[model samples]
Target: MQLTDDRLIRADTDTVWRAILDPEVLKACIPGCENLTGSPEAGYEAVVAQKIGPVSARFAGVVSLSDLRPGEGLTLSGEGKGGAAGFAKGSAQVSFAAEGDATRLTYTVDANVGGKIAQLGSRLIDSFAKKLADQFFERFQAAVEGPGEAAEEELAEVDGDATAEKKGWFKRLVGG
Candidate 1:
């Protein structure tokens, strides 16, 4: 299956790029994502729990970013195995650009599934994937912008007051 979409985030291009590359931000945004380890430069490992149709499983995967241009674009490829539930593998091409004070992020993704997930049929898988993508972007936007501009200030303060604590907790949880 393939999917494409774009989002207009209310933040500068640099801020949006940095946040998207941050594992902590992705962990918080992606539904059922248990953790994300590693970095953009070294590839990333992800553990995600998901339920599709009647099957539920935990997927462990590795993702790598290629064709990278800092604060610009990258192509991400990954594959995940979910024991008896089957497997999924996909790649996404993401591009970023500035739009006034905000950022425009455009993405194109191609993926395939096998086992029980594929057994559920194409329509279901397509809808589920679309829903998950929507949820991810929504949460990502919130994480980057916060609750209006006030929340951004609060985050900056938090980053200052508990810099080590915050980073440590995130690193510990993600095992990075």
Candidate 2:
């Protein structure tokens, strides 16, 4: 499957870039994500429980980011095994541009699935993928917006903490 889209984030490009790289934010945004570990340098490992049509499975995989251009863009790629449910692999090229106080994020993805997942109707898989992507971006946008003032203040307090720990995948996805 192929997917392409863009979103406007109500935050500076640098802030949005940080949020995207934060594992905690990713974990929070990914649908049904159970765990996410590792750093950007080593790639992230994750276990996610997902249901597509009549198939429900726990997928374990490694997600990596490369071709980074600082606060501009990067490439994301990953492959996961869903046991009997199937397997999936995909890659996306992402770009970011400054737009006033907001940041514009654009992405183009190419994905493939095999085993039972491939046997399932394409419509089902397409819809599911679209839904998951939409959820991820929506959550990301909210996170970049800083949500409430208290949250923004907290982020500010830790802005230069340098000692901050790597967040979980959930945090990275949901921007928590």
Candidate 3:
């Protein structure tokens, strides 16, 4: 399957680029993400719970960023396994253009699936992938431009606030 789209974010290219690479920002934006970890040299590892029509599964994957040109473009590639559900692998070339204080991000993705997911029909898979990508970009735009520079500082300050909050609640229940 193939998917493509572009969005304009009301932020500088540098800011947009930083948010795109920030693990916390991505985790907050990605739908059903259970975990996301980034490596300076090795890209990122993600665990995502996805539901397509009547099927639901957890997918673990590694996404690598390559051919990077700061504030310009890069290629994102990843493969995920969903056990009995299926497997998916794809690559997307993402390009950014400066538009005054805003940035325009354009992306084109080519993906392939095998197993149960492959058998589910192309229309379903295409629609699902489009929806997922749309949701990701929407959340990402909100995170980057919502609260101005203060939000950016806050994002940096509390990298794993979500996980920490969960841990805190668990500790309270255990009377730690």
Instruction: Give lDDT per model, in order.
Output: 0.79, 0.80, 0.77
Worst 10 residues of 2 by lDDT: 162-171
Off by over 4 Å in 1: 148-176
Candidate 1, 1-176: lDDT as tens digits? 78899988777777776776787887887778898899888988999899998889999999777898888988878789999999988777888999998889898888788998899999998888777777877787777654545554576687785233222232333332
- Please write out the lDDT profile of model 2 over residues 8-93, one tens digit for every residue: 77667887788778887778877788999999888999998888888998999988989988899998787899999899787778
lDDT of candidate model 1 versus the reference: 0.79
Q: Number of the top candidate by lDDT?
A: 2
lDDT (Cα, 0-100) at 17 in candidate 1: 69
Distance from true location, Cα of 143 in model 2, Å: 1.7
Tens digits of lDDT, candidate 3, 44-94 = 999989888777889999878889888898887778899999987888888
How high is the lDDT of residue 104 in model 2?
96
Rank by lDDT, highest first: 2, 1, 3
Off by over 4 Å in 3: 147-176
